[model samples]
Target: MARAFIGLGSNLAQPAAQIQAALHAMTQLADTQLIAQSSLYGSKPMGPQDQPDYVNAVVALQTSLTPHQLLDALQRIELEHGRVRKAERWGPRTLDLDILLFDDLQFSDERLTIPHYGMRQREFVIYPLLEIAPQLVLPDGTPLSDLQHTCDVNGLIRLSAQ
Candidate 1:
């Protein structure tokens, strides 16, 4: 099974409950196992100041499913949790599940991107990921630890221990 990292976020509804519920749902995925997950974090919205701060976390999964298959499964999970699509980028949502990294795979297409397109610059993604995988190195050989100092925690705060 390839180990993959999935990022979860929510700023709408009861976000912490949404995060925990998503964690449970992940364990039910066929051919997938939720190995580890980080604590909930509160962060300012990436796109607009008008929305509520988001609760975010990262999960590690060992899955036999391919990247695209995993993406499809994650999307399904999001939909089940009441996610809604919008034309506005970074608009608030009930759930946002992203494929942050899939083994050592480096890939992208119209549907998805691995080593997620924006992970490097987002403190909400970087900090929690460090908590779960401190020694992680991206597929391109960039050490995850090296980026921690680059992204300030100015707007990010740990909301829970687990």
Candidate 2:
């Protein structure tokens, strides 16, 4: 099985519940086993300040599914949770799931990107990631520890685990 990390977030429709529900759904994915999961964190929206703050967390999974297969499953989870794709980038949504890493591999396609495009700089992603994988090394050889000092938590607050 390939080990992977997925970042989850929501800022609409009772976001904490949305995140909790997504976690449950992930555990049910065929050929997948939920591994470690971080406690939820609350943070400001990455795009327009007008949107509500988001609740975020990261989860580790061991799965037999290929990367695209995993992405397809994750997108299905988002849609099941009422996600909508909009032209507006980072607009508020009921759920957002991204493939942050997959067994130290690096590749990108129209449908997915490994290491996620912008994870290093996002406090919401960084802290929760750190909580679960303290010794993680990026596909580029950067230590996850090295990112902690540089990325400001920026009012990011840890919430209780569900």
Best candidate per TM-score, number?
1
lDDT of 2 by residue, 1-162 (tens): 999999999999999999999999999999999999999999999879999999999999999999999999999999999999999998999999999999988998888889899999999999999999999999899999999999998999998864
Give candidate 2 misplaced runs (Cα > 4 Å). none
Residues 20-113 of candidate 1 have per-residue lDDT tens digits of 9999999999999999899999999987889999999999999999999998998998999999998999999999999999999999899988
In order, the Cα lDDT scores of the candidates are: 0.94, 0.95
Model 1: CA > 4 A from native: none
Full-model lDDT, candidate 2: 0.95
Q: After superposition, how far is residue 77 of candidate 1 from its true place, in Å?
A: 0.9
Q: How close is candidate 2 to the true structure, as a TM-score?
A: 0.98
As a whole number from 0 to 100, the lDDT of residue 162 in candidate 1 is 75
Clashes of each: 0, 0
